[model samples]
Target: MNHEITELKFSVRFSDCDEYSRLKLSRLFQFTEEAALADAERNGYGLWNMMKAGVGCAITRMKLRLNHFAPLLGENLTVTTWAKENYKDKVIYKDYIIRDGQGNIMVEGTSSWLLVDLKTGKALPPSASPYPIPIIKEEALPEKLDILPIGFFPKKVDQVQGKNTDIDINHHVNHCRYVDWVLDALTKEEMKERGVRSIQLNYIHQVPLHEKVDILRFKDSKHHAVFFGMNAEDMKGNPLKARCHFQARVGFGE
Candidate 1:
């Protein structure tokens, strides 16, 4: 609790695994989020404190690299996360590592977050927080995740409406649900043929509950695909008019 970094232990449950018994990417996201919240709470920037201060933290981007062998169901994992020392005013960088019981790295990730005013939803500087969480210099991924670019006519593969389960305390669709949507856009056969090697997400806007999201995808190559989540009207054949909720890049392996 006194350290800048926080580590928590978790056991992969049935719900956390996929058909292969390997941990789902979305579940891994949830675990990392839990670890992050724990770190913030211990550092005095918990939800109640932030709310009292009229500010809330929102994640803007995340990039994750998965090991060849993902964490399996029932495996014990240690999730460690820390906030990076801020050189900028408006954004915070955070890094994470998930290790198995055998001390092997299962997944590594980095994320960017912004402190926003609760009333106006405008981003605030780090100086505005009720408590300044201690930060470390360590970086999980030195390179920043880029914004995914799509072609002119990216195909609309599927559509999904935000459900109660997709909503979080922030009253919008949780970030992990977007991961699910991205994966769902691909077929089981495609996933089995091309295993997911890495994923990067850029969350552009909050998705309100019950809002229908159109999943559009551009397969750059046999091993890579970029996806965008937009509103129904936004996909009326114009990329320029698309009200993008999020953009993502999914990399696959042989």
Candidate 2:
């Protein structure tokens, strides 16, 4: 029995928030991702299950817009996810929406996922897929706008090494870690005062243990910023690792 749509309830744990008791941006993504995966797991396309079948799921791109800020510590939230039968890069496209207990949307986002071979790490053809994807009209977010790479902005760069804590079951840097690097670079004080209204990210390359990534940020003003960065060593002749385009708004979209 496959579900056309899956919804789950979660509580914001103590560890999910900052000193000010506000939920962190990266943690928000983590919760959303967790919900999506849990649903797929019940339908037989889960991480471990897929890996055993010689295929694995990985997110390639993500774009999120906030209608409101995340729930405070211990607040209950509802998260729903579904896949649209759209195929690109031999992968599936999924949409997500997170709401408070009142059913008012707090966050909405879309994501693209790839199915790759467990050993070779090459993407598999869509025809080879076994699970049935849902046909749902995705909830739309604002159109994407181009943001300049970090190299085109300020010169101050923050360097971070890929450590054990940074690695995930996929054996590379986890997706949430990338968001952490971005918000950390921007700082919590700034993020809280000027809440992030939206964020778009493209996963270009992976950061493995022992590798160093240079995170660069270019602030457009006190309330806006652009983040672009890449690994120190060139991968595939391109220094671009990942780029996060985000907007900072007032009062957490209230």
Q: Give the top-scoring candidate (lDDT).
A: 1
The lDDT for every candidate, in the order shown, is: 0.86, 0.69
Q: Model 1: which residue pairs collide?
A: none
TM-score of each prediction: 0.94, 0.83
Q: Write candidate 1's Cα lDDT for 64-150 as tens digits.
A: 888775678899999999998564787888999888999988788999889999999898898778788678888888866667666
Off by over 4 Å in 2: 140-151, 219-223, 234-254
Pairs with backbone N, CA or C atoms under 3 Å apart (clashes), candidate 2: none
lDDT of 2 by residue, 150-222 (tens): 4345543477778999898878888877777776676566676667777777776677887876665654554
Q: Can you tell me which runs of candidate 1 are displaced by over 4 Å?
A: 237-239
Give the Å shift of residue 143 in candidate 2. Answer: 5.2
Give residue 254's lDDT in candidate 2 (0 to 100).
26
